[model samples]
Target chain A: MGAEYDQHVAVTDLGNGGFAAELDEGWVVGGGVNGGYLLGVVGTALRAASPAKPDPLAVSAYYVSAAVPGPATVSTRVVREGRGSATLAAELRQGEQVRVTALATYGDLAGLPDDVRTTATRPPIPPLEECVPGSAAPEEVRKVARMMARFDMRFDPACVGWTVGAPSRRGELQAWFRLNDEREPDPVALLTVLDVLPPVTMDLGLMGWAPTLELTAHVRGAPAPGWLQVRHVTRNVAGGMFEEDCEVWDSAGRLVAQSRQLAMLPR
Target chain B: MGAEYDQHVAVTDLGNGGFAAELDEGWVVGGGVNGGYLLGVVGTALRAASPAKPDPLAVSAYYVSAAVPGPATVSTRVVREGRGSATLAAELRQGEQVRVTALATYGDLAGLPDDVRTTATRPPIPPLEECVPGSAAPEEVRKVARMMARFDMRFDPACVGWTVGAPSRRGELQAWFRLNDEREPDPVALLTVLDVLPPVTMDLGLMGWAPTLELTAHVRGAPAPGWLQVRHVTRNVAGGMFEEDCEVWDSAGRLVAQSRQLAMLPR
Candidate 1:
């Protein structure tokens, strides 16, 4: 048996717009909880607060501090209940200090107009069997970041050259991902998947804890079941920070989600 | 003297984390205040709340409702004051209704390490005099959407073909922008310029209001004094919504600000 995502992320209502959840230790990325996992916790609370619109369309989170594994409380506020969607705010607090704060809009993605027009091209990926496993991380690094074991990940061989001392310095990473439990990808799950890959900075031969400062994700459509293909690219690494843009496509080749985040580089 | 942006977006301290600002009618894009202008209002308040770190590094806002021309209140809360940056939250409320909510990080951009490395390319733009004026809007459009007159804008001609009834249908728009008041572009002003261009939907011959739902921006560096070149591109227009990604380059040819917004297409 392994740590299942749904169970680890589940929240219990604490009454009066409050929720209680546990930050599982197995999800720690670098001395703290993974940002995507914290986002999932906030997303769960927002979904409960806005039941009329349960699917998250867009979520933007600001990581205030490193979250540790322990009991955390989520306070939610329904900002608006519009005709098309609902806007909500949530803060995950370990105690009096807020760990993560987020603003999100939730609605039934199924209800969105079935219109798909795009100039986006589906990136080609080698068959899953031919790609390098995400677990290809050096054993020493994985010893600390237990989060890597929770997902089934495959990386494009060309992008992970840094692992073997052959860095491309391209600042890009392409991977296929899904939960080890075989849970299907939903809008909420996409939140975790969008951030599953290691920081693209690794591809630049710079590898360390690149903590995300702020992350904003847009769920364009519902994903089809199967491995998710994700592409992450970073354009500029300046001001002691860099911005990473992510695009996720599902088994059906539809653009399921897009996200951009600003993160700091290690000193 | 011509409705200077500084005066229009100026916020008065109301004491106790509250600020009062007037929404100018001339800044309305359709039936409401431009999203970026509203972001500036919130940005100004956040700057005041976190004086230790005055520059805006990252900002994300979710539009809750349409903001009409009138008085608005911005309530700000400083979430964290870390050693490197401060995180803040602001709400733009008109009376009891929250028109917009935002989360931002403030820090001295000048204080950031002067490490510059980017794989991004600068998009080419025509000379100021050779391009079409933004005021080239139809006499009717210029009347209601008075926001156009606030700046001296030049289009890449090739992208604004929709104005002449022939659009490239490429889902992109490129232009040069600067305030008519000759105000130099700063971090705050970049908030406005980033959203100044008419919706890129116009590039697809689909001219109408594309109200922004959520906008996230990252200020990479300080700008050099001169006309700013901007490139707007939209790849996925799905589910009654489209996402526009914008890059703002200063005259010194440095990438100053980058923003991505999800907006709804007129039904």
Candidate 2:
């Protein structure tokens, strides 16, 4: 089914060091695909075109309209090239009306000296054996999980029972996650993972349904070994919008990347 | 100089449920004050007029021109009234031209029981004695720090010294900070604090000058106790643009808000 969904989003190599992909209903909500899955498809396409050592640093997508999931296309253009960073702009469209537009960046690896290093504290890692898996995962997660079974995510047992905790003045969460599918690690895949991290954490805390309005991430260092640690926190949930921030650390404790998202809660 | 700067950009209440402020020299650099600060001042003015509690959940601003900081006015209008959220649109004008436009929301606080609650781990707090004060000493700290002094910030000595650690990555830093200002805090102040947090943390780590380009924050809960903790990390630095995400927690470790910002590094 995942492969079937992947097949629907077609990739076009612009040939001029750029690429594009089309996302149609085979990936839309009513058609069984959702935004999350489409995002995955887009990430995969961008990864396929990146250099072997491509490291995705940031991606910003503007949703122009709801992608019905049948047939849509994404086109990417290289906007700027620099020694440290490269910028690429990608657009998802259906027949002419743009559905989504994204600007992503990739960077070459340049190690910082020890004196320049800095790191955020990682949340306590829970033993997978002790933690219970997530309860009825969101439809989006379930769909993505089925389509792309590359990551293993273990939610705290507290998250599954619906006994999560009261919304304190400060919101906080810790989860264990890593790629389930083994392949040459690509920056696009890493960014896709970062985009998904906030929803689960938000779900574990919010009283109502929270749908992401926008998501932005920054890749800081080289990818870490195997397992990735995600520490996510929601700072405020007012109006219909909520905000979440996450820190992604590699198994070795190096800060790999960080993400922030704006989500609109469903009525 | 700082007081003079404030006067130049001082926001004025326009009365009749509207407010205005001028963009002055201090607010502009190459051209204008940072876009994020412009939105922040307008949001602050809107909050002052509404009877509703001031908790900024989401805001959208468009850059029209470089606002001359010396004198500007903000006019806010109620866009919509919903069962749970109130939407407002604010315009910042300098003489006749609309310099900036913004949309903001404040939700009615309906105390609801939280279903999920988990706090992310915070960095180990360094003792005040061991921590180095911010780059500005008593006088500079007093002047520039007004925007930040409301927050209790403890920088890791390594960051202050611009030293990298084993797990450190370039363009990243981890520090603990909370609102320490004595004034009754409002959503505007929260926004101001959020804007101030990232630059300090990033500058301390990268040892580079960083200025904000855009900031979007989600206010999850009402302001917490006097203290709030923040963890800021820079994700990427490329194309003269950089980004950072900050997670804010109250004294109890509950996540209160989180923010993301796009910035330009000083050439």
Best prediction by TM-score: 1
TM-score of chain A of each: 0.97, 0.74
Q: What digit string (tens of lDDT, one per residue) describes model 2 on residues A1-267?
A: 343334444466767534455554332232233454555556555555556426665555444445654555666655445455455555666677655555565555443222223434556777777764443466665554343343456765544443344433345555666654333233454565565443443444554335554556666666656667666666455444555666777767766666666666545
Which numbered prediction scores highest in lDDT against the true structure? 1
Q: Once model 1 is optimally superposed onto the true structure by TM-score, how far is the C-alpha of residue B250 displaced, in angstroms? A: 0.2
lDDT per residue, candidate 1, A1-267, as tens digits? Answer: 434888888999988889999999989887788998888888888888888898889999999999999899999998888998988889999989899999998989999889898789998889899999868778888877899988888998888888887878988899889897888888888888778788999899887889999999999998999989999999989889999999999999999999999999866
Q: Where does model 2 sit among the CAPRI classes?
A: incorrect
Candidate 1 has which clashing residue pairs, if any? none
- lDDT against the true structure, per candidate, is 0.89, 0.54
RMSD after Cα superposition, model 2: 8.5
Which 10 consecutive positions of candidate 2 chain A have the poorest summed lDDT?
A: A111-120
Candidate 2 matches the true fold with a TM-score of 0.57
Q: What TM-score does each of the candidates earn?
A: 0.98, 0.57
